[model samples]
Every structure is written in C-alpha cells, then in structure tokens.
Target: MSREFEFAQLLRAYRKGILSEKAFEEEMTRLEGGACGGFIAMGKTYASERDAIVAYLQRVRNGEAAGARALEQWAQVCKTDCMRSGLRTIAEREAYHVRVIDRKLNDLGARCEPAADPEIDRFVSMQSDPNISDLDKLRRITSSFANADEVVKPIYEFVDLIKQDLDAKEMLALWAEDEYSSIKWFLHACAALGGAAQSPADSRHEAMASAQTH
Candidate 1:
C-alpha cells in the first residue's frame, strides 16, 4: 500500500478505538520516522506515559539550550540597541530553562542524550551577519512567529496527557508563560523600532488563546 493509504488505515484504526491513544500516537511516530513534535519528538515512545514525558523533557532541554547559546553568541556581536539588555535576559532564561528541565528529567531517572538542532546554527549565522540590519532582524523574528498559535502546542499536548505527574505539567506551563513573555518583549521592541500597528504580544495572545480552545 502507498504510505498515504497506510496512514489512512492507521487513522481509521485509531478512530475506531482498536488502538489505545498511546498506541495510536506511537504508530503515528513510527510512520513519521522522525520528530514532528510532542513526547514522541525525542524519537521514541516509552512503555509508560511518565517515561515518554521524561524523554520529551530531555529533548526540550537540548532545544532550549541550543537557542540560549545561540542567543548569547548573537548578543555579543549585536549593536548596543540590538543587544538591548532584553536579549541577554531572554538568553539567561533559556539557559536556566535548559538546566531546570534536564534536572527534572534526571529526577525521574531518565538519562539524557540530547541532540543539537542545526536550525539554531543557521539562526545564529543569520543574526550575526553584518550585512543585515537590526530592523530586518526584528522583522524576521516577528515573521517567523506567524505561527504563534502552534509554537507551544506540543508542550500543552504533553501536559494534558500526563496524568500521574502534575509537577512536570506545571513546570511546562510556567515555561510556556516565560516563552510568551519573551515573545512579547521582542514584539514590543519591534513596535518601538517603528514597526507593527498592534502590539505583537496582544495579537499573538489572541492566536494562542484560540489554539488552547482547539
């Protein structure tokens, strides 16, 4: 059968309750053959939801650390206004978020073998390019966040599915809040720099709220 047909069959099985939700998601992961998002993005599904969450946590830490390190490097090369103190603060938060999440994963007896994402390297190169103006950088950042609704969807999915562990869920929520704050800071800065009519935070918040309802 074609891959598309196979996926349709899998969806039918899931909808009919022939497979448990976890099993359905795992099968989807297998079909995906790589990370898309959520607990499965660590590239495997555990026998238990808790274990799966631990794996997700490990991946989250690595992604956050990569972003943080890149942000710090960019800050060093940025012009004074571009660095803007806000950049440093967000970088610090991202760094600490990595450490905190890693500790949480280890506390659950999970070993983390994190992988670096090349996207971060590309982002750093883009930011550090002397040929690009900071106005252009601001625009790029705001434009990339056009899918603000889906940006943190994976985190919410993991939290909602985790029943036995409230701590992890709460931690993820707090992390989401920080992410929202960071985005707002950037957007507000963009507005200050003669860009955007509405505050980026206000517009994105509506998108995020809509995402949560769905």
Candidate 2:
C-alpha cells in the first residue's frame, strides 16, 4: 500500500479504537511531513489525545444509553426464563453505566450530544426491528460482542491518556469489568439455548447489513 494510504489507515484505526496511544503516536511521528492524503489536516474532531478520548467516552456513554433501552425491549418479550433474566441484568448494568459515565462526562466538562456512532445506532436498530426474532438478535450479538477483552481493549489502551481525571479512570475500569461480565453472561446463555454461535449465513448477513465496517 502507498504510504499515504497507510497513514490514513492509521488515523482510522485510532478512531475505531484499534490502536494504542503509544502506537498511534509513533505512527503519527513516522508519517509526519509525509503525504497522508489530508487525513491529518482534515476536519478532525479532536484537538489532542485527551479531547479524542473524552469524545470516545461520550460516544460510549451514548451507546450505554441506547443499549439499556434496546436490551430492555428484548427482556420484556423474551420467552425463555434464562435469557430474560440475563437480558434484564445486562440492561440494568448498561443503564447504571450510562449514569456513571454521564456524570463523569459532566465532571470533565464534556457534553455527550451529537453522538455519531454508526455501530451503536445499527445495533439498536437491529434489536428494535420487529421482524428480527429476539433469539436471532442475541445470536448476532453473541457473534459480534462475545469477546470481552477484545471489546474493551480500545478503552483500556488509552489509560495513560486520561491520568488527569482519576474519577473517569476509575469509572472506566469498573465499566470495563462489567462489560466483561455481560459478555460472559451472553455467551453462557447462548450455549444453554444450544445456539452458542451464529451460523455462517447469519454471520454473512450481519457483515452485509452492519453499518460499522471497521
């Protein structure tokens, strides 16, 4: 790939929370003064690493808000006792995290409006769709979000970036743990239902329909 293309990819990976701060910075230094096809000079949202991470928190909080509502919908209509209980528990956890992260955002003087997360939006849409059965929804989610460590690595990789806000750091750690717990619950619940994983057809449909490409 061209250097400029690779440089653009670096910026995108960081935005998608795929790059550690150290790696992101090193790559930025490496590409300094090199042609990056305007990735650096475009209308970037963040002025610094701190700003970008605060924005990340904002987006995630919005996700929790959406997730809490979406999960509750499933919990209400779910016929299976185990799945219902698991969905409710996860919904409650997400709701609590929403409050926690919202408070943290306000403490840091950040407003979480104008969230532009296509991934969360898509998840909520899929869950809310009437045609998609609840079990199928869970299957798709299990396939995409079963790995707790991988899901939250984006947030943990930037611990050094938020040292100024001890409160936010603490909240993040607690939230990450809860995320791991939630995924485990979903995984076990899926197994109990004998649908421990999404079928290849379902996976392909998810990839084709999912709004978040990265």
Candidate 3:
C-alpha cells in the first residue's frame, strides 16, 4: 500500500481504540524509514498540538477514519504531555480538565446540564471549601438549577442557611415558591438520611412471593 493509505489506516485504527502509541510509532517508523518522521511531518504544520488534535477530531467526527485515529492518538499524547510539562496556567488546566470530564459525561449519554451525581458532588464539595467565593457559589448554583436533580439538597441547605443568617422570611418564601420540585427532592433526601427517616426494610422473599402471585 501507499504511505498515505497506510497512514490513514493507522489513523482509523487509533480512533477506533485499536492502536497503541508504541505500535503506531513502530508502524510509522517502518514505513517512513525512521521513527515518527512521517507523523512529525504531518504534525509540524499546526500552530499547536491541541489545534492539530482538534482538527483531526473534527475530521473524525466527520467520518474520516484516519483523522479520527489521529485525533485519538493526539488526545492521549496531549494529556500525557500536559501532565508532564506542568506549563499550563491554573485556569487553563482547570478548563481543560473540565472539558475532558464534560466529554466523558456526554459519551455516557448524560445531560450537558449539571444534574448528574458526580457534577452535584463536585459543586457541593466546592461550596464547602472555605476558599470558594460567594459569587462563584452563586454562579455554580445558577448553573446547577438547569439540572435541578443534582443540586436540590445543596440549594435547599444554602437557602435555609441564608434564611437563618439574614433572619428574613424572604429566603424562606423564595424556597417555598419552588416547592413542587424542592419538596419532592427534600422528601427523597430525608428518606436517604438514614436513622428513622430511612426507607422501610424490604424482605426479598416476601417480594418474590408477591411477584409470583401477580
């Protein structure tokens, strides 16, 4: 096969999760008469590795097998490179990490909104941190509202705290106004709190007999 065809096949394989970096490099080396020269030649035109990867990923998304493989390979390389380099600004690193998490969540068929369990946990953990700002907390809460299931407890607890702190009925009124969704969540949270509020014990054998009767 031509070098171009072989490279394209390698790219497709990588995208499909079939090729390892070592394996890809070995093939490229054998084909190009040296180690990674072919791939390096392809990579040199892009301004940044990330930009190149993004371009390849777009091609992959467009059903180009070679581009898809190149994108996947580049992603792995970029992640490792980022970790090893320690050159990224804090904000850049955080944004990149969040994007990675977002992609994984999307792949899992999760909503882009903040409703999932892990997303809620992340927000709650951040809120509990003494270093986090109130304005940031408000932002997170607002973003979280779009996916209410994940933030209901935190929202209730936060508003409840505000009600106590301000000694005002306004906070309570605001909470009450969201009663339909909040009440159901509150009930569920209460049931989850263990002790006397826990769900009733169920006998598996009794449930089986009941099911059989039906």
In order, candidate lDDTs are: 0.69, 0.69, 0.39
lDDT of candidate 3 over 53-78, digit per residue (tens): 33332322222122222223323333
Per-residue lDDT of 106-127 in model 2, one digit per residue for the tens?
Answer: 8668878846778777888787
Q: After superposition, how far is residue 89 of candidate 1 from its true place, in Å?
A: 0.7
Residue-level lDDT for 113 in candidate 3: 40
Instruction: Give the Cα error of residue 21 in candidate 3, in Å.
Output: 75
Please rank every candidate by TM-score, starting with the best: 1, 2, 3
Better lDDT candidate (2, 3): 2
What's the CA RMSD for each of the models? 12.0, 13.2, 24.0
Which is the winner by TM-score between candidate 1 and candidate 2?
A: 1
lDDT of 1: 0.69
Estimate the TM-score of every prediction.
0.64, 0.63, 0.17
148 Cα displacement, candidate 2 (Å): 2.1
TM-score of 3: 0.17
Can you tell me which runs of candidate 3 are displaced by over 4 Å? Answer: 1-116, 144-176, 179-214
Give the 10-residue window scoring lowest on summed lDDT in candidate 2.
33-42
TM-score of 1: 0.64
Which ranges in model 1 have alpha carbons more than 4 Å from their true place? Answer: 1-46, 80-83, 147-150, 198-214
